[model samples]
Structures are given as structure tokens and as C-alpha cells.
Target: MLDFFTIFSKGGIVLWYFQGTSQIFTQSVNSLIKSVILQERTGSNQFTHEALTLKYKLDNEFELIYVVAYQKILQLSYVDKFLDAIQLEFRNKYKDDLQNSALSSNFDFRQDFDRILFEVEHAAKKQIQKGKVMKSFEESEKSKKSVKSMIENKKEEPPKKSGKGKENKPVKKTPVKEQEVKKTSSVPMATSNTSNGELDEETIRKNRERLFGPAKKKKSAADVSKSPKSPDNNKKRVKVGTKWVLGGTSEDAKELDYTDGTADNLDVNGVGVSLKDEELDYVGRMKGELRDVETESESEEEEEEETVTQKTSSKKSSGGMFSMFKNLVGSKMLTEEDVAPVLDKFREHLVSKNVAADIALKLCESVSAKLEGKVLGTFSSINSTVKTALTESLVQILSPRRRVDILRDAMDSKQKKQPYCITFCGVNGVGKSTNLAKICFWLIENGFRVLIAACDTFRAGAVEQLRTHTRKLNALHPAERHGGQQMVQLYEKGYGKDAAGIAMEAINFARDCHIDIVLVDTAGRMQDNEPLMRALAKLIKVNQPDLVLFVGEALVGNEAVDQLTKFNQALADHSNMTNPRLIDGIILTKFDTIDDKVGAAISMTYTTGQPIVFVGTGQTYTDLRNLNAKAVVHALLK
Candidate 1:
């Protein structure tokens, strides 16, 4: 049974919904399904949420149609058929209403859909039951047929005949007419014998030969032993005019006399017949024809070579003229009209790669500004020129303005007798705790003391997760260290406590212990959650971390832009400072999953004006890699 079903307009407005389960659960499911559909719409049209067993479909008009089930259902065909029927009926009934936007408020579908809902439900139930029965019956029939075939084969094996002086008589073959009559009869036939109650191989062979035609004859031993004719015996040698003629000793050979040499002038029906003397004449003519062919081929080759040289020279002259013109102008400039077409294509490409439409437009505009009146020297074509401009622009935007040197900053803080506090924040499932652990590992590997502050009191296992990471990292002590094994310390105030207060306490403890850096792990919060955002802003305001880096997934595309923007705004507003605390840098997670849709990294950085310091390539601690602008641009373009 369907747990929930929903219909959405092309613009993602929910037009109708029916829930057969808890309202809260259905709402959550609907939100998740909407997010999945939105993401799919950017790249694909259909996707399945395996966790919820929800199936979604988008019609030709871009209307979203979806259904949810309690568990995995094998008979999905019924659901598809039902959805098609509903969509057709709705479109047919509300053809004018759907087209006119002003009619949406007045249109009521509740009463009209009752019949359709009932019919679809009944039809789906009957189809599902019918499918199950047919599947079971087919299995039973297959098993029965297999068992009967095996028993029949065992019973058909003839028993060995006893060796006796009396020979067994051949089985009598049934007439074709009687065989047809027996086949039409209802009585069961015995498997041990034919209709005549006897089994014989000779009789079977004779009957088969009678029904079909006779076979080919086999070769005799004498015919197979005969040898082929020798070359010397097949021809007679005769000398004529300084050449010897090998003439065949057959009826066709008697027409020619080899000794006279008259065969040279002989024309057999205007076709050249080569005799001993005519062979020389034929050779001479062949040599003349070969020479003509060689001359023609050589002339053709020379002409092709000349054409290639002319083309190369023409290209060089054109290139030189262009270079001279640039030198005269004092610089190569890209006019607005020159790159409009190329920029349009590039914008489309970015959008097709799942980059946000607005961001893509802005990126194109930025590229256009950067390219206009810019020097172009030795560039090949408009395509390469635009590519170079875009690559440089992306690299400029992606390059971090403020360098993130964690070890250097921590060391400087250590020398000053204070712990450098760094806080990690982002929405849920962006790997906040995991990335904090990775940074901790990096600091320790560089021979610096690290402390993990478990200030994420909201999540149930947030503190435990930090403790696990600390335990695993503490085990990997560098062998070159002169002192005892360096271990990471975790400070947790347990769940349901003031997170900002705990972070402040952890900072004080780190200062007392002379720790190099204190990595604060904040609870994952959604950007749209005002309460949580305000709480996060309070934590940041109270603690005032040296580095507040935003961690986001690279597969979220433009949504990451919205998230970072809202997060930055919240922090700026609630921090209660004249100049709001800004995100120092971004740490993008899941960089390996989104193969072609990697524009998220560029979009996030370009939108926030923040650099991506490190990208999490995999789940392991060692999977983190320093971000390079060229490498990122290459991956995106590739």
C-alpha cells in the first residue's frame, strides 16, 4: 500500500497531497523527496531514495509525481500505471485551469479526485495480486515439467538383451496414418516401446530414411589413393626464335604452332594471346604502361606537396599580419562584441554542469570584464582565448587571499604561551567532526600539541565521536619525537550543556596546559534553523575563534552558496561586532563523489569570496589534500 503520494507543479509548488500515515513523518518524507527531485532536475529527471523506498517521476510538462511506500515493493509496475492514470486524468480535467495562473486559487481538486483515487487504488490492488499469482503458478509449472522430463528419460533407456543363439526380431514400424491417429487419441502411450510394442535401432533408421531423402555416397579407397598430374607430363617443350615455348598437350593446344613465331601477330578475337615471341612484346608494353603510371603518381604527389606548402605559407603570413596589427595597436584587446558568442556558450556549459544559473551568469560577466581590452599574444583561436581567460579568472577567484597556515599559526601561538583556537561549523552531514579530526591529525604530524574541544552538546554522540578520533590519532605517535608519545586531549562537558561556555572553559584549560591549538567541534546545524544559527553565532561571539572555517559538501552545487551566505549573515548579525566575523576559508567535503558536477567548489568560492583551503577527497584522514587552483580548473574543464 502507498504510504504517501504527492503532486507538484513545474515550479515546485505542491498542488495536491494525500497521506496514509503519520503527518509528521509524511512531511519529512515529502521534504526529502523534494530535495532529491530538485537535485535530479539539475542533472537527471528520475531518482530513487533507497532509504525511504520513495519513487519519483517527472512528466513531460515538468510536473513532479511521487509515491512513498513503507518498505521495498517488488510490484512497481502497478505504482507507475497508477501514477500515469492520475496524471492523465488531472491534466485532462484541469487543462484550462493549469494554463491560467489566476485560476489556481479558485480551482478545487479535492472533490474531483475522489473517483480517480478510488479507481487507481482498486486497480493497483487487483494487479498486484494477479502478478503474485502468475509468478507462483509459473514456478510450479516449471518444476512439474522438469520432474516429468527426468522420469521419462530414465524409463526410456532399453534393458540389455541377453546373449542367446536365437536372434531378436526387428521391431515393426507403424504406418504414418496410424501414427497420426495415435497422436490424436487420448490414451497415454507407453514410454518403454513404440505403438507396436517393440524397440529397434535398424527400424528407426529405415523409417527416418523413408521420411527424408537418401544420403551422399562415400569415396572408395582406390579413388582416394590416386595422385595428381605432374607439371612435366602436362606440357611439351618446343624451342622458337631464341625462346622456348611450353605448350599444353591438350585439344586446345593443337590450334597453335610454336616453331613458326606467327603467333606473335595472331589476335584471338582482338585479345592479345601471348606466345613465346609475343611475350617480349607484352613485356615492353607493360613497362611503358608502368612508367606512365609512375609519372602520373609522382606528378600527383608533387601537386599535393605544393598545396600543403602553400597552405602553411598562407597561415604564416596571416599570423604575421595579425601579430603586426597587435604590435601597431600596442596591445591585443578583446572587444565586447568579439567574445559574446563564446561567453554565451561557456555560460551554457557551466549551467549544464549543474552550476547555479545566477552564479553562472555572474561568472560569465566576470570573465567578460577580465577579457575585454586584455593582451592576447600567440593565442590560437577564440575558443582557446576564452578558455585562457576563464581559467585565469577561476584561478584568481579560487586562490585564497588569507593563507591558512595552521601549524605556523599554532606555533606562533605556542611561543606566545596561548592556544590557537579554530572552530569548524557547517550544516548537518557535511563531515564537521571528521574534518576536525583530520586537522588534529595534521597538527600532530607536524610535531605540535593539539586539543579537541567537544562543544557539540546538541548531538547525542558528538562528544563520543571526538573522543574516538582523539583515541585513534593518539595511537599514531611519530617515531622521531624525542619525548614520550604525544596524545590528543578531548574536553567534553557532556550533552545538554551550554556549548559556548564549554568551549570557553576548554580554551582556558588549553592555555593552562600550554596546548598549541584547540580545535572546537560545533554541532551541525541547518542554515535555515534560526535558533541553531543564533546559538552558533553566540558560540563564535563568546569564544572568538582565531579561525572560523565553513565546512560544506562539494556535491550540493548552488545550495552550498545559499548555505554559506546565510551562515555568514547569521554570524555577522548575531556576533554583535561592528565588523562581523567572516568565514576565514572553506573546507569542501566529498570532493570525490561528484565526478562531473564539480562546479560547486568554484560556485561556493566565487559566491562567498572565500578560498577553499583543503578539500576532503575521501573518508580517511589521509584523503585530505591541499587545494590547487590549476588542479581544480583542470578537473572542472576536463
Candidate 2:
């Protein structure tokens, strides 16, 4: 049973309160609950306060807090059902009052609160009864199974033997046991013919017949243990189709004619003592004739070489081997076809890193054009050359024209006595509010007075979410409380209000209060949403925020480019400016979620020509870090 239930607007304003029987709410207890509600927007739904357990349920416009005090633990499902029912009823009954801030001022919902509680109690009781019936049915089914097993055990028992001297009669076994015995034994079991189950001669004879065949003789253990003898040497070996030749045979040696020794002494360089004078004269005469013939041949060869060279020169001019080879391979100039393989592979590498296909192709093409015809060093291969080129190109693209000097801007705003207004824009679930709070924390740490504006009226709990951040920030760095001025303020007007007007008002308030920086968190809107985009443009135009940083997820790859482009175009058109109202920079959130596919950071910067100012590394406010180009490029390449 609920101890008490309270309904409050998202802004922490109590709308109605109901006290259960024997339940009392002191001032301190009420303050504690309100403090918890203000601090936590989306956390564990239950917390302990004193002796009671406070369970909370949140909706678009209001939050329902139920105080549950019980001796035994209760099911959360029941509590949830009750809370859901009451929340629906209250919202329906007070829709007008909830939407209109004017009516909510004097609205008293205690009258309808009792009726809503009664309906919820009745419905909860019915569900509890249904649960009990299901549990009882399950218990009864278990009991039936236990009783049936006992009866089966009794039926399977056999009667004991009457006398020890009398021949024991075999009892009939159950079919289940019989099947088990049959599966284990290869031979069939013999049954007794007598009704008393006495084994007779015929049963014994049949059992013996089943154990051993009638004609065949069984071998002894000695015969089974002896090994078989080897085959006789004279036995013919099996003749496979292909003959196996082990060593050289005499027939192969005889085919080589080893007996021939006549040519051994016929050496051309050996001296021979013969009738040499006439032979020497003949040799000398032959030598003189050979020399005359050689002279004529040399003259003819020289004339033929000169004629061939002249004919070749007349046909085509002779060029150096290196120049001719270059012309053949076209090494002086490089074409797309020349480096197509390298570019294709590099493009694939970029795509695998989550870079978009077209963007990857463009990067590859740019690299290829720069690398064409360039002589590669001895240590550098095509892959290394391409990687170096890509890294340089990426660094150039990621290097923004102007760096975001947040601290300097804040200081300037402080000097001018006007708050440096920054509006955060992004798609849904890109951590706009969270990053806004992170920036606020950064400003506060830098000794600048920061104020948060919750102008995100579109999303449920958007304002509450920002408020939660501000509460944490204030708790971490408490205000001085001098002259009743807060160091950090969260300005929210609840849901269903003009977000642009709310932002403008917040800015005006910030300016008057001499705040250093005002971080305006806008509702996460898609780039294609025309009306929302126009509204955002109006918000920016009316306030002319000093910095409009686009928050995007690093895991979105090249899609972040398209989103920022469309957003910039929309803002430019709505502002009616010649040049588009460009985003000052990007704040990439969830950077840690994308491990290796960090190419989105490169792609976003490359496509938008904007630098990433800061990155949200984790859930904490301190996780925000400045973006380093070299580290990012190294991470991508590595």
C-alpha cells in the first residue's frame, strides 16, 4: 500500500498531494523528496528516505512520487501499474491546467485525486487476485505429480519368499524393467512353464541352446591368445599393375655400351711423334691459305656491318635505352589507369574506416593526382606513399580556418558586460543538453559566471534534464550567495512554450545579470525538419548568439556532414543573409563509443570545412576535451 502520493510539475512545483492513512509528511521530509527529484531526472526509480521507500514515475508534464512503507517487500509491477493509472487519470483531468501556466497557479486537484486513487486500488486488487489464482493452480499441479509417483512405486513391489528351504520362484517383472534387461543381453531369457515360476528341464535346455550354438564348437583361451605365423617365403607376391623397381639392373647397364673404350685416347691436344717434316709443311701451307681466307672474310664483314648500320639509321634515328623504355612504359606521365589499383585499395581502406564511399573516392582521387608520376624512394612502396598522402590531406581538411577560443570569448563577454550566448543544435539523442552542461562546467571552472537556458520545449524532460545538470554543477561549485545572486542559473518555462522567445528572454536575463556566458540548449531537431529548422534559425537570429556549436555523434560517419550542411543552409535562408550563418564549430559527443571508426570526425570537418572544438568523451562533465588534429589523424591511421 502507498504511504502517500504527490503530483508535481516538471519544474519541481507541487500540483497536488495526497496523504495515506497513518502517513505524515514533515517539512524536512518534503524538502528531501523535492531535492532528490530536482537532482535526478533519469536514474534509479526508487530511493530510501527514513523508513519509507520512495518510488517515482515521470511523464511529459508531471512526475508522480509514491511513498511506499511496508514490512515486507512489495512487487514493483503493482506499484508501477498503480502509478501509471493515476498519472493518466490526473493528466486527463487537468490537461488544461497543466498546459496553461496561468491556470496551474490556482488549480487544486485534491478533489479528483481521491477518485483516481480509488480506481487504481480497485484495479490493483483485481490483478493481485488473478496472480494468486495462477500461483495456486501451479501448486496443485505439483501435488498431483507427487501422489501419482507414490502409487506407481507401490504397484511395482514384489511379494517376499515364504520359506528359506523351499525353491525360490521367480517373480514377474514390470514391462519397463523387462525392456531394460532385453536391451543389455544378446541371448534371449528362458521362462518357466509352471504357474509358480519353477525352472524345469525344457527351460534349462532352451537357455543352454541360446547360450551356445548346437553344432559349432567354441575355441579355448590358449588358441585365441596365440599370434598368427608369417607367410612362407616361396609364396607369390601380389602383382600390382605398375612394377616397383628397387635398384639398378644389369639390363639397364648393358644398354649404355660400357665396353666401348676406343674414343678415350683421341685427345686433340696430345703431341704425336710422326713423320713430321712433310706434315708440318702441309700444316704451314694450310695455315697460310686460312689466313688469306680470314682476311677476305674480315673485309666482307666490315662492309656488311656498315651497310646494316646505314640502313637502320635511314629507317629510324637511334635513341638511348632509358629514353626508349620510358616512352614504352609512359613513366614520365601518370594517368588514373596507371595508379588505379593503388587508389582502389586506398579508397576501400577509407570506407572500412567508416568514411563515406563518395568522400573516400574523392580523397583517393586527390591523393592520386598529387602522387602521379612522382618517383618513389627506395624505402617507400605504393601503400606507404598513399597513406602518407592521405594523412596529410586529412590533416589539411580537419584544420579549420579559425580556432574556437572559448576562454577568450568568455573574457571578452565579461569585459563588455554582456553574456557570451552559445546555442547548441543537433539531432535527437546526440547529447546536446549533456554537452551543454559540460560546456557550462568548463566555463565555471575557468572562473566565468555560467547560466544555462532550457529552451528545449519540444522534448519531454528536456528542461528537467538541463535542470538536473545545473543542480549538480551548483552542488559541485556552490554559489557565493552574496547579494542573493546565483553563480549559475537554469531558466526554464516548462513545456509547450515558444522556445525562441524563451531563449531570447534567457539571454536578456543573462545580459542584465552580467553573466559571462549563457549556454542555450535547443531541442534536438533533424536537419530536414523545416519548421523546427526555421524556429531554430529564428532563435539564433533574434538572439544572435556569439557561438552556435553543432553537437553531433562521432559514430554517424559522413551523415554528420549532410546534417550540418542542411542545417547551415536552413539557417542562412531564414536569416536572409548573403552568406549562410555558418556553425562556429562542432562538439562531437560519444567520441569514446566509436573506437576505430573515427573517420566521421575527419569526414565532418572535411566536408563542412569546420573544426571540432571539443569532444564529449564520457558521461561526466569533466570528460569534455579539446580536439587535437594530430592525435585524431593518428588514431584513424593506426
lDDT of 2 by residue, 1-638 (tens): 56667766545566666676665655434654544443221234566655666666656223334333332355545666667666677667766765566435655666666666677778778887887765565667666676656665667666665667565678786333334434767889676646554566776677677777576668675655553654555678997786546335676655666645543442211212122343223211211101100112557758988998897565554554443233133223344466779778877877788787767776776666455545555444556666787788777767666777778877877888888888899999999988887777666666677778888898998886776566556655555533444557888899989988999889889888788888898988999999999999888888888888999898886687789789888899988765556688888889888776778887777666677888888886656776766667766676
Provide the global lDDT of candidate 1 against the true structure.
0.68
Per-residue lDDT of 531 in model 1: 90
* Every model's TM-score: 0.48, 0.47
Instruction: List the RMSD of every prediction in angstroms.
Output: 32.0, 36.6
Off by over 4 Å in 2: 1-334, 481-485
Every candidate's lDDT: 0.68, 0.68
Runs of candidate 1 with Cα error greater than 4 angstroms are 1-334, 373-380, 478-482
Residue clash pairs of candidate 2: none
Candidate 1: tens digits of C-alpha lDDT, residues 1-638: 56667776656577777667773455545555545332222222233445345555445333445444544544454565666667777777777666575334544666655676677778777876887764566567666676656665666666556587555666886644435534765543223345655545665565545555457688676555554532444567787665346444565476655556644553212123333443223221211001100112558758888998999678768888555333233235567787789889988888766677777787776566445545555534666778887777667667765677776777788889999999999999899999888767666656677888898898888886776666566544422242753447888879988889999999999998877889899999998999989989999888889999999998886687799889999999888898778788898888778776678877887667777877887776555677767666766664
Candidate 1 versus truth, CA RMSD in Å, comes to 32.0
